[model samples]
Target: MFGDMMGMMGKIKETQQKIEETKKRLDTVLVDEQSNDGLLKVTLTANRQVKTIAIDDSLLEDKEQLEDYLVIVMNKAIEKATAVNEAELSAVTKESMPNIPGMDMFS
Candidate 1:
């Protein structure tokens, strides 16, 4: 029983390490989103850190339109980034989890 407990502890530690590494890797993954008309663009890392935002010169003339475009484009970019981040972390976690009964959180 003690041996099994020790092995499980070690596996859990290893999984934690892998999760951290995966998060770091995700920082390099970029998600790009743009408006339908291609006037506004946003870029974010998989970690959901805003990298850049580009607005067309025409958008500068209309404050309300620019704000609306920003809200839509930014939300889309963040949604994509969140998905990438969650999927990557979930994959790492699911791969490292031990086969213990009732511990199937992913399922």
Candidate 2:
């Protein structure tokens, strides 16, 4: 029983290491998205931090429409960034988890 416990502890350490590496990988990921008409573009990191925003000069003539376009484009960027983060986390989870019976990976 004690030997099993030691092995489980080793697996836990390995998972922790993998998760840290995954976080670093996620930091390097950038997701970019644009509005349907391509008048606006938004870029964000996989960690969901806004990186850059671009707007076409034509849209500057209409305040309301420009605001709507910005909102739409920002939402798209956020959604894409979220997907990137989730995919990274899922990869780490799958890589870390062992097929050990009666084991709760997170517990």
Best by lDDT: 1
Per-candidate total of colliding backbone pairs: 0, 0
- RMSD in order of candidates: 1.0, 2.5
Model 2 off-target regions past 4 Å?
A: 100-107
What TM-score, to 2 decimals, does candidate 2 have?
0.82
Whole-model alpha-carbon lDDT for candidate 2 = 0.84
Query: How well is each residue in 8-46 modelled by candidate 1, as lDDT tens digits?
Result: 889989999999999999999999999999999999999
**Best TM-score goes to which candidate?**
1
**TM, every model:** 0.95, 0.82
Candidate 2 positional error at 98, Å: 2.9
Over 1-107, each residue of candidate 2 has an lDDT whose tens digit, in order, gives 99988887888789889888888877788899988888898888898988888899999999999999988888878888898888888777777766577765433
TM-score of 1: 0.95
What does candidate 2 score in Cα RMSD to the true structure? Answer: 2.5
